[model samples]
Target: MAYSIINCLQAAQDGVDIICLSITPNRRPSGIATFFNPIDMALLSAVKAGIFVVQAAGNTGPSPMSMSSFSPWIFTVGATSHDRVYSNSLCLGNNVTIPGVGLAPGTYENTMFKLIHARHALNKNTTVTDDMYIGECQDASKFSQDLVQGNLLICSYSVRFVLGLSTIQQALETAMNLSAVGVVFSMDLFVTAFQLNPVPMKMPGIIIPSANDSKILLQYYNSSLQIDGDSNKIVKFGAVASIGGGLEANYNNEAPKVVYYSARGPDPEDSLPHEADIMKPNLVAPGNFIWAAWSSVATDSVEFLGENFAMMSGTSMAAPHVAGLAALIKQQFPNFSPAAIGSALSTTASLYDNNGRPIMAQRSYPSIDQNLSPATPFDMGSGFVNATAALNPGLLFDSSYDDYMSFLCGINGSTPTVLNYTGQNCWTYNSTLYGPDLNLPSITIARLNQSRVVQRIIQNIAGNETYNVGWSAPYGTSMKVSPNYFSLASGERLVLSVIFNVTNNSSAASYGRIGLYGNQGHVVNIPVAVIFKIL
Candidate 1:
């Protein structure tokens, strides 16, 4: 934390415009909300000094309650993608071809080898170790060398996707150890990560992400002509390759959606009962398969040379895009505070994917239910970052150091006592001011079982005009904003009191959005999530 703080401070002191952090503390299982941990505290402190902090909402998503960087002061980012995928096609022995991805360049011509399925290789035993099945191509030494030698081996990839070459390489090493001519690994999930296309195929292999491809290959392996009155089954395979690549916003998908690995929110802080109803991941950007500059240092690790760029996927890639967008926002509004800048970006961001459907995120990592449900503000925060639209956001959800300080005093029994609390007494301010009432553009209730009013104030940065209120309440919850329609002059402010009345039918937690609209596509979406709990 100290090291991160020092670097951030130094950069700010050097007159750096923005701080985009792609790194985080790995020791902790999840991110600390605001001041509970050193890094978040340091970042919150830095934000107070007008240093815009754009961070990655860790890549542990598609899982419930897995999010980091929930601090309202920070602009947390999530990743999204399109249908565009890097294709590496492979030809089968039956003159059939299937799409695949590999790092090996060129072709591995007709070199026939008998196909061997992992199920057949397993020792004939009624009971076997778990690793015996999962470790087929993963655990090379376990294979029957005499039976596998010079044959094309088919194995299942151990995880969802290849996180790195080291994982796939391990499987390759196993194939090599068994004297197998090559291997055909199948992926359990579709990932937009890069596939290498290095020449002289590394261990002569190819990878397919579809389960159907595995079934097709298995069928062929089960077909063989009887020879010498002996019913025999043997499959022949040929020409294998590998490649590298990634993708985001193919702009061709039925709808734009958050990648499965992108972190989500309801702010993990909701783990505590009656805690702050704070939503996180302040924004979203195209992070998958992003092409950027890479290390040029010559190394034996990769198969190709003279390549100084690569297409990669992850939150790290997404955060920098936000950083650049933040820098651009700063360059235009040189006098705006960090919070104001963030508000502008969020307030004017885009909400619809290419298909005109609301932005959606995957339900869970291993889910195949393709009809993805709409993404809540928890997953998308404001929306997709729009550089031009952010230049002039009509209204700003502005807050100051004092307001945040008051917030610190109101969270679940105050943030952390060590946050310069000795200088200021928590009782001096509205100890009643909870975390969600920090003058943000959104409203939330960590636990809502009854009717209540959420106080909020919006500043009109645009010239005197009439802006109407519109909203979508979560199921079983009725909500309304007092003073629904308001007219404000330039540099004026308006207080819109929001009320949420829960219904007895309310069961599980619900999430929805409320939008304030003006002409010329000016829309401010406020997210509200009510944790249905027995009070």
Candidate 2:
């Protein structure tokens, strides 16, 4: 499937300035046994053909080496949270408030409505069983209008809702038909854990996602109930509640954090347990709960079934953000190469968010508490992208088609291997280059021996200016850059030799960055990560 798409892209490469491949196949093996993926090689072909490629780092994340976009030539993107989020609350008649998620307007702050559970409002002759959708409010005909009218209807979050057999949209329709003022979804006690993203609601609503919280709501409802003492357990409902406005977005101070599901980096390499020098996710972009256009006929989001737009999340969405930014950069610099554009984005990215705090990443999966740690180069590449900064990146780390070919050759990719994917013979170019010599904006040394020398050549695309180099050395490692300060004119390039020396042996990886502070208010940042082994 990917091969076919690549073929089509190759055919249309001339007209295409940027290609955002937002899909990923099942992960391939990582080691010397496999030289290159056919899809990756095809993407390289597109890059060499002057088409910039942006890829989504796969969604299977919060784990190490789980990235599916590992190629150095492709500008891979990961997901991060933006600064805005809709937060709603459920205020009970007893003055107890529970936090929840719902994207809908709220009733007046003091306007409390009579509340009734769905089961308590069932039709006298309804044939639906409790095991079905009776309490889910999927069928208005099965509910009594007199019992639900002018009331906030409480519905059950059952297995049917989990399996996609029942949806909040259906419940909403039933609520509207029954003349209910609002709706509340009580979490099922049987389902131990469930994560609910915000759902779009036309009317006021609140979804209690925690089982314990649902139990408290149910207990409150039972307390206000007038039971008939019959075997059927009939009830005259009397609970009251109000819905808080959720449509108003709250500003998240700690935003641009690498989401829990966003794929991490340290690209896999030719040797088992050893990663590549390239970063997997080249940068991070807003991907969580992004409101985007949706096809009304699409069934991907039940909440937006008939709506023209929906809130979506994933690396696929994140990749398009980068693709759009790349388009902007390409428009400003029509002559910019694919490598130059990517370099501009990475070098100008923000390691800190708008709040002036270091960007963080979710370190654990299913994090109810949302445990986070400072994000590393592996977590968010350079960082969340800064659109304004990217357009005027003072310098760019540029590479050519031949440079990529040499990288392929460095992996000992044979002529037949190169020919199979790129249709280029390995003998046509210099094949002795090392993987670490790819001149990328970011540096990663998967296996750092005691001492190593790496070099970078950056071109000044802006006015003539003097740049003073500053660096933070990785833990247990010392770094020295020759000619700490230099001046360059527009369109001129300078070579920098960086020497790395190990001060102590450590088993884990460490990270740092090299910053070039220009006199003209231009800053270029290069992220560096080094992995250490016992000496």
Candidate 3:
């Protein structure tokens, strides 16, 4: 039956162009080889037909021997974060009150000092004092008195025991008992740490840098040593310096290493032990922190709180991007087969990282052999997919549907019989009777392997003088024309078809549209709904 179908398709391949496939895996019982699934059979068939297939690497990582999107006949992609740097310090102003510690209205020398506010210590009504040492005060009565009356408390790290006793409940109790407004505790010199009230506090508290703490302490000490009248004076010191964004934005050009979270690989060695035998992850695409069109409903929903848009990190996001580019490639070279297109995309892709060096080791370090590196065949295949390169004439490979079926039958040791040719609804196709008359014109889209192929027929009721035919496919699906301009003799019928291979199975569930174009801008369209189901 497969042989008959192949013969029919070959006979009808007059004006056919390209074929593409999207590959995926099927579920199987444990301890069994998983290579004979339907999807795998379809992919092998598409490759034999010489079509292109694009695929996505699975999002399983942060460990050794992970199974990524692995398929020898398709292109795969990885993800990355945007090259943006975050600020380490938050800005503060003079109006921000530091009640426990006195700021003698003067700027002072910078020194490292830890910051501890009453809020962090779980105390509410504590005050600060220069003479009050940390970890030394034993009596709650004396400590409570010092905490309430003192403007600021200065103590050695040893007194932390007294402060540590101030639990949330105790702090609340102390707040009521002392009627103090605020507190400030100095952090240990070796380690800097602070915490805010788990619950809201009536008074505000902040964590300042050690340098700020030292400056405030020095100014307080200087003021206390001065005469009474000196308190009114405002001392000026050098301005505080900070790193700005404008200067740091150039960091990408300086250091373009892969982020810490991206997956790394060397085929067979890094891939799941079972996946070592397959041609894993045919290629790689930009999956890192990529920005794309998001659903308005999902973005605008209140569940996100105030954020309307969000950035996600995963291979899932990267899969659709490659799908969209496949559509573009299809549009440019309609005659290329899906396997050819896949090969073009992989072989023509750029193997170099942002640093202009071959991507060898996983993550972003350089290596000696481009192919032998752990990340070579697994983490990334042929580097990142280049849309423009795949569209170029030099990168095209053309194949037919018969070629694909032959490949599928070869892999599974199954011969295609009339019973094996499933119809649109998975019913058997009747070869005896011609199919129902398709309204206007219709195309049957099918996937034998990981590639999508269309079976289109043109009836010439009007004496065919080369009538124009045109259509369009969705964003991720591309189309190509074989024999772009064909001369159909009068009263003659022509059967034309093209196949689109799925490159990345990760995005197979996405909806795509196809557009057909012909002489004088004539156009027609067919919607392609790609589905990914786990068998």
Candidate 4:
């Protein structure tokens, strides 16, 4: 991993403006004490080289502190659903339509085929007793070809499938082997709720996840069943269903939402027991049901075996969206530093959705019952990225190479350690600086003992503009910014001090924002996060 990071850094040094890492090499380490591994140190080197870096926050989420990208210098991104979706429906012969998910072509429109469960079509010759092999259809040879041919095979969705023991590919192959026209996956009854990611299918398919819907399908199938009266009941398949094409994209007016699997954070850790005074997932972007380029040889998904395009979802996908926008910023502002570019994106991000309501985050695991609430700094660092606003952000909080090195020093990074990674000795600065003192677009004081004063520097880049500063204090605290209103000409910089006083000693983190409304139609927002802890 370290070697790969070095290769990427070498590319950046060779003039790559932006680097998007959709891959997470170390996702288990939660705290800052164990954060800066060799891979992280390598990324720090990349950031120091004046390259803008964006990394995925990781997919193991809705779990706090479950982030892999922990460096304060690296811009992390989380996933969000952008109002577009692909829906598939199953129409039973009885005219009951049930919504489901899958990426595959449908069978002949309105053409119903016989429906038979995997258990009902078992071959008399095989002796396999495992539920996965029988009901889950892991093995095609265990099912009779004569019984399944020209029918819609009903396969069971199991926990094994979630654990990678069983796969949709296996089920699709089983259906093909049995000459079935289409496939239907019934949700696992025991494990009522689990995230069922859409899988690519060459054949017509649908996964019914709702318990009520699955019960309806089951009841309908049973009613259509014909049993010959004998000492042993012989079954005749009568249930029929038509699969709808799910490949069509549907765009709606729905607001973009932080996805369930996108990792959340209150940063991570500073060194030991204290949390890092940094906002992770610098922002959120479109990542759900994204249609992107795919490698033809990649065996990641069976449905896209030789296809050049596929629909996928993850924080990995979200990072690229930010990386692309960063490239645009670089093109427009050739003199902009990495920190300036980052600030542009952060300060101009939108906290509200198209509906004018606060953006929401998926607080629970993926299930039919979607649990959501308003997102916070920890859930969505600044907010959703706004490309147009970012291109014209009037003011930016810029940091330099020395500024980052000082941040390392403030985090208790030793002089020799800093030299080893960045080839810079912290002793040269001969000053005291804390991690929270860095002039970042956002402010986070993980541990506020009584109170602390943090400083920030903002440079006017758009025009000579007068601005009125406004702020909402974080819960349990009171804050006041020095010189509430100030005017700056182009290329002029001003220093501001924020004084925070603890009103309530609460361990829970508080969130707020500072708004800089300018007369030149420029608005910059800085997010504030802190925890008021009494000694």
Candidate 5:
């Protein structure tokens, strides 16, 4: 991972316009560095050297505190879906259809196969846990070859302490080992409520939720029932499923709707004093059902992709869209700093969808039921990216180099000389900084006391624009903007303070936005993220 990061940094140093990272660590990594090493510093240098870095907010999400790429310099992108839904026929004998996502490009002869349950076959004598049954599937040797062979095995897979991908792999591998036609996976509850990663499998398979299809399996399967009469009776537990057709290449695949798997934030990489919690997943993009060009030489194509184009999904797909936009923005403004381009994207993005509603996000986990709530900055930073609006953003919360330095001071809360980096002398210059007060497009307050006030400066980039302040108040909080109405001529800047005071309330996270709308059709939206508690 260090070597790869270094290689990318070197490419940026060699003048690469945009850098995109679709890959993530094999394991969940903690800390912002792999040893506070110089390679990590290289990432900082690359972004500081005017290269726009776009990173994937790893697919392990809908879980708070699971977000990656916390660097403010890097544009962290999340996965979202457009409404052009894909349909694959996967119906049970009882005529119940379960939702699944796949595109095989050719129709298969739908056939009924005997359904074998791994748990029933492996542990008939002794009662075992779900993990033990999962182990039987994960370790193919644990299951009886006579029982599993030539049948469609039903396996229970759960996310214990890691991403669900591993469990999916285990279930599929078990079927492959036994010469089984296919495997039906019952996904255990995860933070992501409803997720469908359209990967090509060896034979063919579908992941059904334990809460849904698994119940259907138990209800219809005669093998799961006991003998009530002289003869044991069995109900039909067969399925007819056909996997074909990838998401078509079209521009109308609607998006900006959060995927259950897209990483949400209150970033967990708290390496400095005040850096414990910052807004992330800076923007969402069309990640699911993405029909992207594929390489014929790719090895995973046979198992997880298509021949010409593939329907790949993840933050991996989302980051590239933002990176491509950054490349265009760089071409439009040759001298624009990376930070400036980031501000443009954030300030110009729309927080609302075409339905005139706040963007919908599913953020739930464990015993919590999935709830589609209006997304806030924490769910989707500044909202979805708008390349057209970003190109000529009328106003920008342009963060200068010093502004970032102040941000570091805010994070470290230590004397600048303590770290001993060049031009970072907090002791010798203006040092005190607030995390949210750093002139960035969005805001995040890790710990909002009884009342907290932060200042923001918006620079007018468009000619002679007057603006009005419009905002959403956080739950249990009253918001006040001093001098809400204002005007800014070209090349002018204005400072405004947003005050968030705790009203009669309990304790939790609060999310809202402060919008600056101009008369000349210019709009700047800044998200406000706060974790308010009694002081």
Candidate 6:
């Protein structure tokens, strides 16, 4: 691994502009921490060589404490749904609506009914009442027996409420417990629920109307038997595509709206322990129920079940959409640094929701609709990422490899060890304290005494305009530029290489700067800082 890191660093130094490190692989713990480990050494070498690393925030979720590698240097991203709804299916008016059963205790009325029936029948002599606690179940078999005896069952729709089990599995378990010939559920809780026929039960499992469930439960308590016309009144609802269909309500089937499952945040209010200081999900993108590339043999899909390339929800899916967009920006602005690119993307995002109102931060229950004042830093870093705006940002900042190195070593003033970069190849240095030699944390770049090589590639837009490139190093170091003067024909490309030699041993830990000066006073500045071994 150490040797691989060295080789990778050399390649980067030789002008490999972007390196994507998949910190984690499916079915295994992420390798992200390895990159942060002091023992790895290669990570530091990479920073010294100057590389931008983007990482996934990890898939662990539904908990307040779960985090990815949680390092300041790495850009961590979480998942969100592409759109709010799942697959669209036509629901005939006569079709049964299954009120999801066995859901969490605080589930909607429709869900509560199914839970009551499932629990009552399984428990035999025990009668289910409206106030029965659904969360108290510890035995699936005992619950199943109760469900078999009762004509109805209720369950929660969310994975966390269901205790990490699939809804279908829970339904089947309920059916087996109850010896009843059929089942009924409510639709108020889950808009995405589907009906599966031949549900592997001696009795048929079906969803009913929420109104019907309420009526029957009220009458059953008052009279204790079947309510007339309950079974015949259930109907299925059709799926509608809302957002990505285009700015208008007209369904396009091409683009959908952002999904509800995506994680949202107001920037962290207080940097308390166990909480993030930075607000995330800077912008929303396609995530909910999105169909995308997947492992060839993975069984995560609903239709193919175990087949590769399936539809999934969560911010995880939304993150890659932005990553792909970032790739596009790099292609357009070859000279832009990663930090600049981040800035352009963040600053040019969209702020309004489909309904034209500002986005809200409320995330749960009846009070979930309360709206808070919106701030660019709070609701969104800038706005939802706009690829076009990023591609043609009016003003661009260019950063060289050295600037990033200073950032990694924590010598950068006042800013956290991890810095947020935006603009066109531009690196922005932020600090909490102000003043020269400011007690603020500062990032400084330095050169090593030994021979070092660095390469950079600058892509020309429109394949037009001939330009000349030059370089300079900080006062204490000397560098030799290869092909010091090169012509980049309109719609052409140029690659430059620079070799440096440090003045002395002290320079090994000294931070300095490097500049790439071009025509029209276009300049890219890079800070070079060396890592200090505390021991």
Task: Give candidate 5's TM-score.
Answer: 0.75
- For residues 27-48, what per-residue lDDT tens digits would candidate 2 score against the true structure? 7655342327666767777877
TM-score of each: 0.77, 0.90, 0.41, 0.91, 0.75, 0.46
Write one digit per residue (lDDT tens) for candidate 5, span 438-487: 77788787766789888877777779988899988877788988779998
Best by lDDT: 2
Q: Lowest summed lDDT over 10 consecutive residues: which window, candidate 3?
A: 433-442
Q: What ranking emerges by TM-score with the best candidate at the front?
A: 4, 2, 1, 5, 6, 3
Residue 195 of model 1 has an lDDT of: 29
Residues 334-372, model 6: lDDT tens digits: 655565555445544554555565433323222222423
TM-score of 2: 0.90
> What tens digits encode model 3's per-residue C-alpha lDDT throughout 1-535?
3543353345335332332222222223132223334444444444445444444455543232344343344445554333442212211223223322111111122321222223222223443453243232222343544334322223233224224532322333343344433223333454332211112122211122243453564355443332335674323221121111111122353122222234433232321222342333444554543444445466232222233343444555566766677667667656445544554465455555667665444332112122233243334534465666555423122334443333223332233331143222212222221111111122222221355445544332223344343444433445554444454543454556656554444422233433334343223333333333222
Pairing residues by index, what is the TM-score of model 1?
Answer: 0.77
- Where does candidate 2 have its weakest 10-residue lDDT segment? 266-275
Provide the global lDDT of candidate 1 against the true structure.
Answer: 0.66
Cα RMSD (Å) between model 6 and the true structure? 14.8
Give the whole-model CA lDDT for all candidates, comma-separated. Answer: 0.66, 0.83, 0.37, 0.82, 0.66, 0.38
lDDT of 4 by residue, 345-373 (tens): 99999999878999988877535126888
C-alpha lDDT of candidate 3 relative to the true structure: 0.37
Give the Cα error of residue 532 in candidate 2, in Å. 0.8
